[model samples]
Target: MYKARAWLSRSFTALSSNPLRVCVVGSGPAGFYTAEKTLKAHQEAQVDIIDRLPTPFGLVRSGVAPDHPETKIVINQFSRVVQHERCSFFGNVTLGSSVSLSELRQLYHVVVLAYGAESDRALGIPGEDLIGVHSAREFVWWYNGHPDGKNLSPDLKSTDTAVILGQGNVALDVARILLRPTEELATTDIASYAWTALEGSSIRKVYLVGRRGPVQAACTAKELREILGIKNLYVHIREDDLIKSPTDEEEMKNSRIQRRVYELLSKAAASASSQPMLGQRELHFVFFRKPDSFLESNERSGHVSGVHFEKTALKGGGPGKQYAVGTGEFEDLDCGMVLKSIGYKSVPVNGLPFDNHKGIVPNIRGRVLKNISGDSSQVENGLYVCGWLKRGPTGIIATNLYCAEETVASISEDLEQGVLASSSGLPKPGREGLLQLLDNRNVRPVPFSAWEKIDSEEKRLGSLRNKPKEKLTTYEDLLKVAT
Candidate 1:
């Protein structure tokens, strides 16, 4: 009943006239941005944004660190997009499960796949499967209250040291959570269960290990600055490690952001060396150390004891072209917990042509291809891709704005060039048909108003705890609250 009136706001029987029906799979930044752009570009277009979970704002709700609330302000803009008369939001409707990609194409004129990376790149080393090892993605999801990671139950109680492999913003976020005072985190919207676990954690030192030098650090300066400023956290940056090589110096000269980050690292190292605050909670920045393997603990069977790392140095290739090559020297750093933050990779939907090697859908300028050859002639009719699914997992949240623009532009260009001309020249049933298909399957989709109920309930509970909003970390709780 809601879907019938979703697009045909004035009439219940049929659409106005030849409306361009668009279905966006994924309610994250990319999906929402695609919907917004579509609606703006085509006045006669109707857009539906859907996700697998019962709530919208995919990564903004589940991926962003709780401490970095500022980064999630984009949700307000997206809220306005779904509030548009020609747009709607549907949750609890999965593309590959509840409805197939073929089903979506038949119901709508165009279908855009924007579902983001659901898995991380594997470390592919021995002992990585040890009990204490986890991907930084899982750890972030666990702490952020993502339902999939609600029961991660990392072993924070067993050891005083935690080793994080990678130097990205995510690595710093994980490091900050492990080292930041729980009292400060309590004021944020961190999951109550996670807060309880971290409040009792024995982890006092976290190693933010990177394969390359500081100049090539993947983390932005803003993230790096925040980690260095955490109160009572003594940051360890080796003075000798800060000495940039020729390639590193060239990189810094070309990039202002890199220069600023290295300067921050240098300042932190100088301050720590001069002040020498020993025995305090520490956050170590270990560069030029590439993890070779995880060492099994003799004390605790099937658990990790430490990480075996090979020393690495930069191989010159001019500015950003440099890469790390391992040297003969090796070292071991003991730690009870390990989180590898290498990167995230997108999982392919059932009917999509995904390039397994690149971990993205095979697309050219946002047009989905029939295969991985990437030829313009192979563009799949009425199918498109955007965000991390179109490109590899990289860039910040704002990056999606530009990426979505390219996809939407392609859609517009196709419409104008008659590339999407209907063979029958007839309007699609769109949401009206989709609702019937879903009803037959007995799959109920949560609407935007229903999501508002969950949002309100979360905020109410959070107010009780003096937090921003306490997340419901289980599907049962979220669905119940929505109901």
Candidate 2:
């Protein structure tokens, strides 16, 4: 049996008298930042940040490109935040799956749904369901040792020509990973098993596909620059995609990264016409075509062979206004592997108001809106959101510092107005939910103690490998050694 009464202490005063108990659901930048800011703002406040994975730092651990170790330095700062005495880090506790949202509300004065987007947005093409097709989210996780990543061997062996469906920084990362040398990958936190498989990959070409023209590409200038700088990867671009002339003064203010990317891309386009790709592995950046279907190798094989596309033209205004004008020309890009990096996907937490379309808890200025009253300006208190789950998937690691600040400020305001403390914490569901999960024989979640064993073991394995660490990829392997 589980004890809620003993855990729930009425010793803590309401916001009107003192601090509030804040529970943030997710340990990503947004969640950690929120926790850090709240603790800094209030002396008596206690914070708990929960994560589904035994380890914390959601995207920092699983989403960031492993080769970019500098970017991952963020984990150190987040680790400091979690070590605060007022802060409690709960690992291996999954919301929605392991614990109901109602129980969480009863345990904390305010609950923030910061469990960032978990699913990948689709390209809606025919070959999506094929064997070689995968989402960038899954692929990145595999290389980064995310607990739920699929085995890397299957995807690595099946493709020579890979097509990625997006122009964001994530797409560039996949392209670089596909072509980067084995020596380059050894220095990062990429899983050893995944790197070993990638070292032997047959993939010779990676195409970063975008549905709009080069000027409209969502990829940041810095990502495009680093990608082109890869020594082993041959960066290719078509002349048609090269932006010809600057339109306005604002357009002329391109960042240094953008200016450098232009110089490199111009050279690539010029060479694309004269040379037959220099090396076997070519990273071609393509734009202005929308996916039509995923070409599968007969119904029996269930393997993705290629992708069909409908060439698109710009319409109306810039960026957001630029829609797929007229769909006339059609083209097919041959690809053995397909990665839909179109975007990110998230779902509403149980017992919270969710906008089905946006896949986020509905909030106004970080304040979770319970109901739209007769007067629309006012919002009910006691709930909030932070991170990707709050503001969709975008922004660099540092940007979350500001995002979390805003939510924490709103929470402070709510506390000053005596909104959250009135509700107190969520109820005690006891072991009923966990018992059901155990009955189903879902992989036994690693307890905090078990995670410590895994952590120590991983470090021990890393010492032998001459690298940071190696992770156990399988649930069976993890349980066998961890237990």
Give lDDT per model, in order. Answer: 0.88, 0.72
In model 1, the runs with Cα more than 4 Å from the true position are: 1-16, 274-279, 421-424
Off by over 4 Å in 2: 1-19, 243-263, 271-273, 276-279, 298-300, 318-320, 371-380, 422-453, 475-483
Tens digit per residue, CA lDDT, model 1, 306-368: 999999988866899988899989999999999999999899878788899999999987899
Tens-digit per-residue lDDT, 1-483, candidate 2: 012222121133444343467788888888988888777766667778777877777888788887787887887788788778777776667887766777677656677778889987765545577788888888888888876884645467666799988988888888788888878888666788888888889888889888876656667767877877776556678777775433311332544444455565677677554443556568888878888888877643888888888888766553235555547888888878888888888866656766656666667657777643323355545678887777778878887887777787777666655566543433322233343543475635554456568767877887887767676666666666657
Lowest-lDDT window of 10 residues in candidate 1?
4-13
Clashing pairs in 2: 105-425, 105-426, 106-425, 106-426, 107-425, 107-426, 126-293, 126-294, 127-294
Number of the top-ranking candidate, with TM-score as the measure: 1
Model 2 score (lDDT): 0.72
Residue 91 in candidate 2, Cα distance off native in Å: 0.9
Would you estimate the TM-scores of all the predictions? Answer: 0.95, 0.86
TM-score of 1: 0.95
- Give the Å shift of residue 209 in candidate 1: 0.6
